[model samples]
Each structure stands twice: as structure tokens, then as C-alpha cells.
Target: MNRPTYNLLWRLAMPLVLARLWWRGLRESGYRKHWNERRGHYGARGAGWHTLWIHAVSVGETRAAEPLVDALMALYPNSRILMTHMTPTGRAAGHELFARHGDRFVQSYLPYDTVSKLTRFMRHFTPRICILMETEVWPNLIAVCKTRGITVALVNARLSERSLRRAGRFGRLMTQAAAQLSLVAAQTERDASRISSLGAPRVVITGNIKFDVAVPAAALARGRFLRQRINADADGDSGGAGRPVLLCASTREGEEALILDAFKAMPERPPGMLLLLVPRHPQRFDEVANLAGLRGLRVARRSTLGQDGADLDSAVEVLVGDTMGEMVAYYAACDCAFIGGSLLPLGGQNLIEACAVGKPVLIGAHTFNFAVASDEAVAAGAAVRVVDAAAMLAQARQLLLDTMTRNSMGAAAFGFAAAHRGATTRTVELLQGLIY
Candidate 1:
């Protein structure tokens, strides 16, 4: 409804939220360790004012913010950044990503969206600018920032038709939150229009920053090593001739069952073809591994393998990528990649990473979260959209068998990624303008 009602509702829900957080900590202990931060409490303030504060809700948002973060750091060399997150995974990723920066980059859990909590956070950090990654427009957070003279910008913002419809249910609350944004650097014109519909006053088409993410050299080296391990024959002879790897990256809960079933049902399956299944969440890694094993597919975990992957079983049919921050490595190691979270209408994971590594891309029909990218990628012959898991496997079969076709698609994928590489530059310019 309105701001006051929203705040009241949030206050009422805090207990339940804390309970959920504690429950999640049973699986991921990081949630249990950040109680004070979640409640807007922090230790003694020792540092100077943070130049910029960024709120990235979870892992995907945190990862997507990497290039923009780099650009911001380069532009404002003297300034420090305060990164905030809602999930432990996001915090961990932020820590890993900016660990090189040391104290210049600080992270904390974003407090609940209430005036008091946000005010405390504002007072503690005293950041001049608030940059929200993607679709994180909290009403109280925006209102509090505005009152404290903090310029709020929504960068690399996107809004799907489905999301718009959902936001419409909140009516004025969502509209007011959007209207408070100083700028919205949208990924596409459609996103800008949708955000505008939600009353964002200053929306700009700055493209998607994810396309600008540099493929890490370390990741490439790891990929090469993994490829060597994956390609080894049963006799322990590592060579160029080996199993074809089909990476199902960022797969969600229900989608894994469908994918496993489809893999099992595939007729005339290629000899020594491996399924590299990487689930989107860490909590479900064991669940996915068990699912593969229950289907009679031999599974090996990436975590169990040594640093060199020397212990990777040659006869393993499925390799569970249980590790974090190695998506690019997985992409580089795979011959073909199926970007997950789309098959069952969960709005799709990022396919851009796989494309950046010059791999043939396979996606599902429900890519509304990445609507423009998915459509343009398919149009550019860099990706193919399948309607179901069965179709996904079928296309993977064709791509795995046809070396020339796969190579052509890989080339196109790399070209597509290269052509959209300046979003970070544009976004940084906009942020500079906002700050000045």
C-alpha cells in the first residue's frame, strides 16, 4: 500500500524473517554469524566516510556488479566502496572479488528495510551515493537515503513484463521508490520503458554491464587443467581425445530432475559424453549429486577433486560443480553449455558467461529475465532456445556431434559478447554525473 503501511508490515515480518535466516543458517552458517549486521548494529566506526555504497541482493547481482565495481574503483581512486548484501553467498562473492582492494572495499549485510535500521546504516557508513544493482528498489531504503541526502542510482537495471506486473500489485509503494532514484541505467530499452512505467524519473539505456565482465586468466588456466582431467581416458591417459562435456550451469531445484531424466532417456547418446551439472545454490549440491546417483549416473564432486583435479574419475558420467566463483572455468571446460533456471520458468541464469568463453550456448524458452540478451543472442546465431529439457539435450547432441557447427556458434558467441563490451564505461560515466 503506502510507505507507513509498508514499514509497519515490515516491522511485523522481522521476526519471521529472522527465523528464516536462522533456519537457512542450519545449512549455510554464514547467515547465523551476521545477526548484528542484519539488525543494523555494527562495531565502532574506525574508517573515513565511504564514497559509494552498493546494495547487491545475492550472488548473481554481486557477480554482475563486478565489472561496474572495477570501473568505479578506477574512476574514483581515492574513494572507498561499501558493498552490502542480503545473502551470505553474495557477501562471500564480494569478499573474494574485492579482496585485492583490502580495506578500500568493505561489506556488510543490508539491514531490514525499515527507517530506523536504514538510518543507522546510513549514519555508520555515511556514503555519499547509493548504487543498487539490478532490481533492488526498497521503499524504506530509498526513502531513508533520500532524507539523508544520499543520491540513489539503480545501475544495470532490468525489469521484465512479469516483474512489472508483480510490482504493479504494490502500486504507490513501488512507484514512489522508483521515483526517488536519481538515475536508472537500464540494460535495454524495454527495461527502461518498464522502469519508466513504474515511475523511475531518470532512466537511461546504458546496456548490460555483464557483457563487460573480463574472463579471468586464472579461470582460463583452471579450465585448461579441468579439461585435461575431464578428457582423460579410463586407462588414466590424458589426451585431446576424450568425453564431450555438456555443462548445465546454474540449474535450479526442479529443473535438475527434468534434465537428469532427459539425459537418461536420450537415445543413441554419444560415447563418453559427460554432463557437468552445476546447481545454482550451494545448499542443493548434495541433493543434485544424490539425484544423479539415484538415476544410475556415476557422479563426482568438483570439491572432492584435488587442486589439479588429478582425482577426477575418468568413468564419471556427471561432475557436480559444487565450488563457487568458478563459472567461467566451467564454461571454458565445456564443449556446450545449457544455461539453467529457464526450463521451469525461473527466469534463467546468465548465459553471457558461457558465450564470453566461446562456447555454443543452449537456453530454455523462459528467458524473460534476460529477454533482450536471449533473443539477440539467438538472432546472432550465438545461442539456441529450446522449449524443454528434451530439446535442450537434443540440441546439445547435435552441437557435440557437429564440430564445425559448434565452432561457428562459439565464434559467434564470442563476437556477440565482444560487441556489447562498453556498458561498464557508460555506467561509470552516469555514476560520475550523479556524484558531481
Candidate 2:
């Protein structure tokens, strides 16, 4: 009912959590890679120099942290950053994202929320300040940081209605945990209100940091090359001439079946239409590829391609994007993008990246995870939200069939992305007051 009780329960659940991790490691090896780090026994690597730390839980959060990380690196010229992630995907993404600045950044798993581990982690890092990206709320971590006089802030903070309901189950603990946050830079007024209701002391609307993600020039170039290759293949193969590529980005479990079913039912798709199905979790990559194959589509895995190569066969109906850290490239290589996880009640995946790359975007009905951005994008003529798989397929067909409409939507997508660009700046300014 309160912090103490919650802490005790969490401790009791530790074994089950470890067992879950072990089971997950059976599928995803990353869960098994850094057992000690998760337990707060960091050994020599934990003995760090710089005190500034940023906690990004998974791949999405890690990618969103990029611009903020860049800003932090610039703001603190001589200091090193200790980046933390809960998932191995996030850890890998952190390394890939900051590979050039290897010496300036450190990546590891944030310790499990327990007193002993929290104490050890704090003593090891001695962090001056910590930035919690998105909604990574660990009561023990926050309480310990507050006790140690470490500034803890949540950047690009958001609270979906569903998340708020879940947090309400432990209202007292959540309120206490939230109250300790030095700052809550929320992405929207709705988020600010919910976070405030949860007892976050200082909440400010800073928009979503994801709007500031820059599509690398190399990604765009590679995307263009891949498109050209597809076009070349189409030209050579009469069976596949003049088709468009549609990317279904970050699809969840049940949604893939619907998408594949709709695609199969559509007998009059464009001449050589290709569907790029990218599931949200790496563990589902093989399963999704299998789904595509079972649907009688000629499926190819993106992982099989050589570096910067797009030697896909003309007969391929669907391409399974089984690779990591190249989402922007997938968006750029497509004529239109569909934001996944929304077809069911799955609270949609981020569509900001698709818009940032100047692609016309589509989404399913549910998008509460990115509610404001999705609504605004549709209002701005940059995105289309369909109620079901059939609707999504129809919209995708229209976009592929109508070049003028798609081009206009793409232009609007760029403008919409550009209009929401100052979140990173606002976030950095807020953190400056706390740390600088």
C-alpha cells in the first residue's frame, strides 16, 4: 500500500524476475549477457569517472535519447556519460549510436530496483545527476537518488491512460516515487496532467524528444540506393514492374496476421507492390517471417542481405526486416509507411520517425501511446489513421496508386515533423537549470 510495502514485495519478487530473465535468455541471448550488471555487481567496469547518467530502458527510449545525449555532451564538454538500459537491444543501440564517441560514453544495465543493488550502483557511479528517459519509474532508484542529492529528471515523459490506470493500483508508492523527481518534462498537456496527478512535483510540457531524431544522411543515401535497386529489378522483370514498397513498422503480435491476411485478400495491388513487415521484438522475427511464408507470400529476410545491399528477388512479395538499428533506413526505402501496433488495442508504435524521413504515414485506430502526435499528424494532412486492417490496406493502396496525393502527404509529413522540433532544446534548457 506504501513505499515500504512495495519495496518488500519487489524484493520478494526478485527470484521470479530472475527466473523470467533466465527464460527470456532462452530466446534472446542478450538477457543472459550481463547478469552481474543487472544485479549491481559491476566489478571493475562499474568504477566509473563521470557522474552524469541517462537511463533509457529499451531501443525506442535509447534512440530518443540521441539528441539529448548530444546536447548533454556539448553542454558538459569534459564530463563522461554513463548510459543505462534494461534491454540488450537498447544496450546494442546505445553502442551503435555513440560508437564514434566510445571513450565519452559508458553503457550498462541499470540495477534491478532493490535497496542493496541501488546502494551499490549509486556508490559506484556517484552520479551527479540522472535523466530518466520516457516512463522508466523505479521507486528504489528515485528514492536513493533523492537521498544522495542526485538530480533526477524525466525527459520526454508521457503517461498513457492505460499506464496511468496501472500506476493507480499502487497509488501511494507511485505518488511518493514521482514526488522525488527533480523535474518532469512531459511531452504533452495530457501527459503533464497525468504525471502531475501521479504526484510528480514539477511537471513541464517539453513536447516529444522523438520529433528531434535526425535521419542520418547515410541512411537516406542507402535507402535511395535500395529503392533504385528495386526499381531496376522491376524494370527487368515484367511480372513486377511499377510496384511501390509499403513498410509496416514495429508491428506487434496479433496485428501481423491481420496485415498478411489483408494483403493476401487484395488481388489488385499495384503491379509489383512489396510489403516490408518489421515486428517490434527481435524474438518474433522468425515467427513473423514464418507467418508471411505460411500466407503464401515469397518472404525474404533483411538480415540475409550484404552490407548496403538490396539484392531482393523480384518475385518476393514480402521482406522481413529482421535487422536492428536501421529503422530509418527502412522508412526511407519505402514509398509509404504504416505505423504498427495499433491495429489491435496495442497502443501504437512511434510514427514520428516515418514522418521525420519525409514519408507519407498511415496508422491503425489505436495510438494512445503517441496520442497527441498521431492526431496532430492526421490533422496536419501528414498521416492517415485507419480503423482496421481492411481500411489500412485501402489507404495504403490509395497512397501507392496516387502519386500526387502521396507526394503532398510526404511534404506535409516533413512539415509536421519540422514544426515539432524544439522539444530537445526545451528539454536541454530544463536540465541546464538543474545541472549547469
Q: Highest lDDT among the candidates is held by which one?
A: 1
- Clashing residue pairs in candidate 1 are none
Minimum summed lDDT over a 10-residue window in model 1 is located at 231-240
Could you give candidate 1's per-residue lDDT for residues 157-250 as a string of tens digits? 9999999999999999999999999999999999999999988889999999999888999998878777777763332122236787899999
The C-alpha stretches of model 1 lying farther than 4 A from their native spots are 232-240, 307-311
* Sliding window of 10 residues with minimal summed lDDT for model 2: 232-241
In model 2, the runs with Cα more than 4 Å from the true position are 45-48, 232-242, 306-310
TM-score: model 1 vs. ground truth: 0.97
lDDT of candidate 2? 0.88
lDDT of each: 0.89, 0.88
For residues 1-436, write the lDDT of model 2, one tens digit per residue: 7877977898899999999999999999999998998998977645546658999999999999999999989888887888999999999999999877767888879989987898898888788898999999988898888888888999999999999999999878888889899899999999999999988889999999999988899887767666665553322121235458989999999999999999999968987799988999999999999999998999888877545555667899998999888788888888889999899898999999999988899998899999999999999999998999888888988888787888899999999999999899999998988884
The alpha-carbon deviation from the true structure for residue 401 of candidate 1, after best TM-score superposition, in angstroms, is: 0.9
